[model samples]
Target: MTSVWDLPDFDDHEVVHFVHDRISGLSAIIALHSTALGPGAGGTRFWHYAHREHAVTDALRLSRGMSYKNAMAGLPMGGGKAVILADENGTKTPEMLAAFGDAIEGLGGRYVTAEDVGITDADMVAVSQRTRYVSGLPVSDASSAGGDPGPFTSHGVYLGVKAAVAEGLKTDSVRDVRIAIQGVGSVGSGLARLLTADGAKLVLADVNNDRAAALAEELGAEHVASDAIMGVDADVFSPNALGAILDEKTIPGLKPKIIAGGANNQLAKAEHAQLLHRQGIVYAPDYVINAGGIISVALEYLAQRDGEPCSREQVMERVGRIPERLKAIWQESAERDMPAANVADAMAQKRIGRA
Candidate 1:
């Protein structure tokens, strides 16, 4: 579960902590790849790990991925990831997120925080109480922002997916193409709307039944069990729920020609990309395809700190590049008989290389 990187050339990342009531559960890491560009920015993920090393591994992997994501998305910030070790099933208290906010404050302006998995706008507000080192909070007359980026994230992913579909459906159009979406959260729901508007049919499922059914009803799509989504005869498989879904065993069961979703780190291992390629499935690397939310935040940050007002159009214009990026990656992988993940990794790394 550890990344095998000879990062001897790179400086070791900084680790920080915030404890409350003698509870050290609110731990976080702030990795600065290059602040010569701007502040290190990324999201805070609250996860329940079996061991401390697992959490470390998650933080390292996510931080590195954020670096690549920012570079590819043309953002001015370096990468970082904050992880709070606690059970998501209500075991962690608001104090834990607030304490984590204190840790972000400790970073001063070195890092700016935002929402990620297992954290919400409310959680960001709690953190804002402790530090101005966070974004994605409530809006006011004094401030230009505060709201959920779910819809925007979904919009970018939807655009990326549409690009994938058009390329995927050269033999056919996406009209009535059955797409299986594996999460009905903000991202997935927004994707469903885009698909429906484009006359695409969706087979939707979520661990959250209420939201899933609501989305399905809105789009006139079918609802299936979350586990059943993999084999649902879908033309495009969207995994908006979780990551590492394209492993060895599940690849054989997937009934999709193209795979594109907002989940980070879709491959269980780098080799899984090879397996998917061998299976003839066109897979979009998560980092390349899911850069929408972070890109949006990056634009806002750059605008505020450096007088770079990234308009909504300019922000979305970056999203438009995702399709072209995917097409190039798929073409290169096919021409070279390489893994798409490697292609994406190389593409993303080139951006970091420039930095």
Candidate 2:
């Protein structure tokens, strides 16, 4: 906590740029974990952290996750992430967006920015006005591979959950399978809809009570308090919210046979992977399963850079491979008597030239 190098989440980051613009009230941390593969590519998160240290931790952890995510997803991009520290009121302005974009521009293509939690495509547009190193922009056509990456993320997660069900339960169908989802936001809600259509019974929870209730009512699913989601008796517990929820304090209470979702850094620490393995739970490594969004945006960015058009079909083709990667991770986990998360980390590390 005293020095960034001493922080537990700091994973030998390539560059950690701290930006402070008083006139625009922009305070941000941009952490590039790796650029060995290509430019560090990831999204920008706008969130209110109670403490500055927590914000730094998030930036560090998320940037490292992005590196693994991009590497595992087979993208030329490496990994990086940006965090804009919001105040208690979560105030955001155009000036802040422009300044943030300027900061990204100053990186000189080493980093590319997109949209993440609490950041919308429109916000990315504002950020784009100042920098060409921005993506997740609204597209002119629905068939184009550019826009909010939420649906792409949800699609990959949905496929990953299905893969988990097949691997752990020895069944290819999700029909009547019980799934408890933590966080009914954009990604989670899209996942719920997909699973609902496939005849899966879902238990939904989110910090926004009303949103959870509405989605549950619409899907004919059950709703629970966010804190109580982990204890839900279900076939799979999908965490689509924040990270570090699966630690010593929560893993023992997990009632699911499989854990799969789009949340980044689901494990609080590296050792926690073994705890889940000891519990006999099949885990779909978060980065491996949640690479859909980055795949979409990375492809879009590459296409734009090369003066080519990116199609939705191309993105879907890459996303459809998520299940295959999860299958490989789970297989290695079983063969090596290792946690799936650890196996995934090893694979990703090799991909990023860290191993």
Candidate 3:
């Protein structure tokens, strides 16, 4: 068990809350990395971890990323994240969600929670019953509501891929470019549809073979085993699943010329960015490209504050800027001879008044 005082480098973080509800078996950590930009806003990720330490690490890393993501996207928000230690059986109940929501409410709006991996719109709805400091709820008549952020997130990533391809491959289009996608969850599936419609040849993989097979058939693309995905000789490799994919074991064999996806913390460590650059691969920082969901939810949060409904078109318009931001980062990377990840971090730090 980790205590807030014992957390590594706690001076750099603004707040960290360890929450537990015995009755509902809710164990969660809420990490607020910063509030310099605004109130901390990020998603609640539900996953089963072998040790509580892993969950704590994930919450810290992801919350800091959220802070950077918000700053880089020019949103008036700070970075925060929540992680729920769940059962492997996927038996999340409404009572557990309510308990988590209560924990979030206790923060007094310093942090806002949304849906992330292993979380859904329904889950957010349940969370909202106990706290207003939640986003990504289905649209309702009572107030401006937010729903699943997957499509918007996917759209942002698709645009980022275009920018990366143009700079990395010197191409204007994804059409006919072989793209390998890992994870066919909501965001990945949405990206597959967009890329296929744009004529990109796809190779897909998912732990859930049925999900992968279904998307492959829908896009008329090839399917590979999840473990074999990193080895595919594709023009671009998009990891839409969990973090730490671009780590030591997988980096050596990763055959893609470009790395751009919706996953947060794609790099196993900061050093992996240099490794990618050394390999002549263009690496789009995951947080920069994946800010679409937060951008949408942030708008929703504003609308709720103003007692108005969120506009999808308005959200998409803001999401469209992701490519422009990525293009600037890629250019800076070239001019400075730095990894794109480093460039992105610099950009974010500058925006957040940390540079």
Candidate 4:
């Protein structure tokens, strides 16, 4: 097995903690990529990786992404992530949650966790019983900024897609424009509904066939097989799925003029950004467009820590700036003949004192 330090994704991570609780059958990895700006704040993902090493790699990549994401979003928090290793059956229990919570408590506030894939706000509530360093708890009022971060993320991506259309297609209107969306999960579905209301032609795909079919039917859009989505001729291809999907094997076949979505770590490697640029596709850095969720949760945590109120409207106001940041990156990319991902990375690195 390759050592963690030798992994390509390991980018000078400050801490990588492996956790095990035999009694609760809990096994996890908590990674802190940086604490230069503030405490490491990110989400917890509960996933079943075929290999334990894959979990470590994911923790490394995701935690680093969170660092960049938070810095670019102008948040005071740094970056960290926790990945709970699930069994083959994807079993999760209260005991496992409690044990994970205890482990987080042991971190002494250096890391704060919320919700991510296979994790829920309710699970955060459970985790909070063991530690004060948590966010994404269920808010009693809908006007509050803290809760499920999905809708916030969707809103930011929707705005980014519109920005991409304006930049690449030279039009502000999405009406009658074709958009092929991959992964009709919470974020994708929310983006689809928003675009549909704007009269954008939609093609939806997801690994969940039933969900995709139903969303297409409801939105009066078209549905395609997950594998066929990239090949669909559309003005935009929005990937809301897992990371590393935009690698060499897949980028050449993509027919969209613009690639923008809420998926984190979309590029398999740094060079793929140039690949997309060479293909003349306008790319939105995933962390920039997807910072809405983290912004909401981070603000919630900060507000709670300071005993202040954070409103949903304030969160929306912050999220509304996502498109502007993306536009700036795009502008710099064009001026310098650089990929937008590279531009965004340089800016984030400078902000985090990494440059």
User: Model 1 residue 117 lDDT?
Assistant: 84
What would the per-residue lDDT of candidate 3 be over residues 1-355, giving only the tens digit for each residue? Answer: 6665576634377888989999998999999999999999999999999988888888998999999999988889999999999887977988899899899999999998899998988889889999999887787543333678878899999999888899889989989999999999989999999999999999999999889998899889999999899999999999999989887778889888899999888998888899898888898899999889999889989788778766788888899999999989888889989999999988888887788
Runs of candidate 1 exceeding 4 Å displacement: 1-25, 29-37, 91-94, 140-146, 171-173, 307-310
Compute the lDDT for candidate 1.
Answer: 0.75
Residue 280 error, candidate 1, Å: 1.9
Winner on lDDT between 3 and 4 is 4
- Give model 3's TM-score versus the native structure: 0.95
Q: What RMSD, rounded to one decimal, does every model reach?
A: 3.5, 0.6, 2.0, 0.7
TM-score of 2: 0.99
Cα lDDT of model 2 by residue, 86-130, tens digit: 999999999999999999999999999999999999999999999
Which sections of candidate 2 miss by over 4 Å? none
TM-scores, one per candidate: 0.87, 0.99, 0.95, 0.99
True-vs-predicted CA distance for residue 351, candidate 1, Å: 2.1
Over 4 Å off, model 4: none
Report, for all candidates in order, the number of backbone clashes: 2, 0, 0, 0
Pick out the ten consecutive residues of candidate 2 with the lowest summed lDDT: 1-10
Ten residues in sequence with the least summed lDDT for candidate 3: 137-146
Clashing pairs in 1: 137-146, 303-308
| lDDT head-to-head 1 vs 2, winner | 2
